[model samples]
Target: MESEIGAFVAVATVLTITPGLDTTLVLRAAASQGTRNAYATVFGISVGVLCWGLAAAVGASAILAASPTAYTVLCVAGAAYLIWLGIGMLRRARNRGRIAQTSGTARMGSTSAAESALRSWSRGFFSNLLNPRFGLFYMAMLPQFIPDDAPHFLMGLLLALIHNAIDVIWFSLLILGVRLMGHWLNKPVVQRGLDSIAGGVVIIFGVKLIIPVIFS
Candidate 1:
């Protein structure tokens, strides 16, 4: 049990730090909306982990893994979702640097904090959920660590806890880093540039996800 727990921590740490859609979404949200919004995004994303963990524990992920056709279908669906999201982000980038202001003054409070948090949560949830790799990650990786004698439910839950805790810590630090940008984070030009980069990266991820499924 002790060895298993240690292994779970090590695996979770590596996986959480691995660059992925979730990381990008959280960081981008933080840059755009500051720390509070970023935290909300992290919270939503953590919920996603909870879902995945539960699914994994109950053998739901295993079913998907065992059925090649179903797995492929889901992978393709996830890729399509990412492409759609990337397109939307790119479109938003068109107006990224052009915050409406009164005369020459910037309207600091055009959007409320509540709205920002909601938007961040949306970004985080969709970003985490639609990343096809996430499902595969659990499907491929989690089983490797579980002993045949280990209780599946207990192991899965523990693994999920470790994964989410690591992710929360990593993302929190990122939000803190972006918060350091402070007032400069409000600059429309910087935000727009970030949107453009994020859009392109997400599109590339979508393309990457599709190519394999199509060819395979």
Candidate 2:
């Protein structure tokens, strides 16, 4: 079990570090908002991961993985969401000049602290939730690590928690790295560039998600 866990940790670490939708979202949050909101996003993402993990443990994820109809439905929904989010980011980048002036006032406006955090959190949560890949990944990977004699559900949950923990650590490091460069990263031009790149990546992921469904 320990060796299996060690191998799982090694694999999860590599997967977590690879740039993905979550990475783009966190980087954009840190650069555009601050560490506080960025962490909120992280928490939201973690919760989403845990939910998927739970689903996998209970055999819920297998339904989506095995059922082409269900998977395609989720794939399309997730793709639409990603494209929508990406378009919003691109618009923000285009209007970054205006954003520089209006952003502060907007933050100070009726948007309360709770509201702000909820918005950021939701952004991360839904981004993860709507994607079927997480469900598929958790279902496929967790079984590989579970020992023959162990309880499947509990073991799957444990593995998922481990993956989530690693994700939190890696994302926190990314937030810190962005904070260290806050001075320049927050600049209007830099923010614009980051938004553009992030937006493109998001849209690409969305397109990738739906392309197979479309052609199949």
Candidate 3:
């Protein structure tokens, strides 16, 4: 059991640190609204991961994986959503100059900071939730950490918590780093560059999700 937990932690750590939508969203939130918003995005993303992990524990992962049509449908939806987000980011980059100044107001805007935080949180949640593979990732990767005959409920919950803990830690670091670069992130040229890069990466992922892999 101990060995399995350790292995799971290592695997989760590697995956958590890998660049993905969650990381992108956290960085975007932090860049746009500072550390507080970044934390909110990270929390929301953690919630999504937890939800999927719990669902995987209950065998929903198999159900989704078993149905190619369902998986395809989810892939299309998620891909479309990502593309939309990319477009939005690009638009923000194009019109950043029009936005109100953030001289020293903690990046507040027309609405309260709390509202922006909630929006960031939702972005993280949906970004993860929409990926059908995420449930399967938990279903597949997490079981490697459990004894074949072990009771899955408590064990699953524990693994889920560990995964989320990794998430929080990595994203916290992202927020901190972005906070340190707060000045650079909000600059017009830097913002445009980020928008272009993030947009391209997201669009590529979206395409990857939808494209069928051919085997000889």
Best by TM-score: 2
Per-residue C-alpha lDDT of model 2 across residues 1-216, encoded as one tens digit per residue: 999999999988998899999999988888887777788888888888888888887889989968999999999999999999999999988987775454342122445667777777888998899999888998888778889998988987888789889988999999889878877775678878888999999999999999999999
Runs of candidate 3 with Cα error greater than 4 angstroms are: 104-106, 213-216
Give the distance in Å from residue 210's predicted Cα in candidate 3 to where it truly belongs: 1.6
Question: Could you tell me every candidate's TM-score relative to the true structure?
Answer: 0.85, 0.92, 0.90
Residue 194 shift from truth in candidate 2, angstroms: 1.4
Query: Model-by-model lDDT, in order?
Result: 0.74, 0.85, 0.78
Over 1-216, each residue of candidate 1 has an lDDT whose tens digit, in order, gives 678678878878877788877777777777765667778889888877877776777778776668888777777777777788778778877865464623212222455768868877876776666655676677677777778898888888878877888889999888777777656766767677777777778888888978988888
TM-score of 3: 0.90
- lDDT score of residue 183 within candidate 1: 69
Model 1: lDDT equals 0.74
Order of the predicted models by TM-score, top scorer first: 2, 3, 1
RMSD of each: 3.0, 2.2, 2.4
The top-ranked prediction according to lDDT is 2
